[model samples]
Target: MADTSPSEAGNAPLDQMGLDNFAPYLMNRIMGRYNAALSAEMAALGLTTPQMRSLAVLSVTDGILIRELAVYAVVQQSTLSRALDALVRDGLVRRETDATDSRATRVYLT
Candidate 1:
């Protein structure tokens, strides 16, 4: 049997709590494995996580606004900007001024 009791500080030690019982820890572990596997595939394709994420979103919603793409890709705008720059340089994607909004830019897979 496992001791599930909290310590004097009113927080149970991680070992006692068991890693499998922690949702956040479990989620992080799962994501770590997923990222590791994805990293290899991305490297083979010459794509980083942000770049791949951007392409994924664009595949589903082509010509999406840059701001919206950042949200959908779950990356910071600055990171997405750099990734998009590389993608554009590599000829994987293209950026264009939004037809409806001159100030906004849209991303599309090429």
Candidate 2:
């Protein structure tokens, strides 16, 4: 009555596959371990992984539009917004309206 082929089933069930066999899961696990190791150092500086990434990118690029920053930082605008908000509040980063484009907002490290 219903298709039950491998293609129709989409991804294999998690229980059927070893955790190491899933790329997404493996990447997440790797990042989780790295983040865990970095947690103490990050906490001392009052930064999360995303916030650290945002700052790191800004530090290299200096001034970049929020959209561009999101690209380099590998985060969605909505997600980057939270990190930017904290950085702005902490005085670690600054935001200025773009002179040529009213709708574009540029961010820079302080």
Show where candidate 2 strays beyond 4 Å: 1-24
Candidate 1: Cα lDDT at 38: 97
Candidate 2 lDDT, tens digit per residue, 35-79? Answer: 798877988988987798898898899889999999998888999
Can you give the lDDT of residue 45 in candidate 2? 84
Question: Over the stretch 11-68, how does candidate 1's per-residue lDDT look in tens digits?
Answer: 8788877888888999999999998999899999999999999998999999999999
Task: Tell me how far the alpha carbon of residue 37 in candidate 2 is from the true structure, in angstroms, after superposition.
Answer: 1.8
TM-scores of the candidates in the order shown: 0.81, 0.69
lDDT of 2: 0.88
The prediction achieving the highest lDDT against the true structure is 1
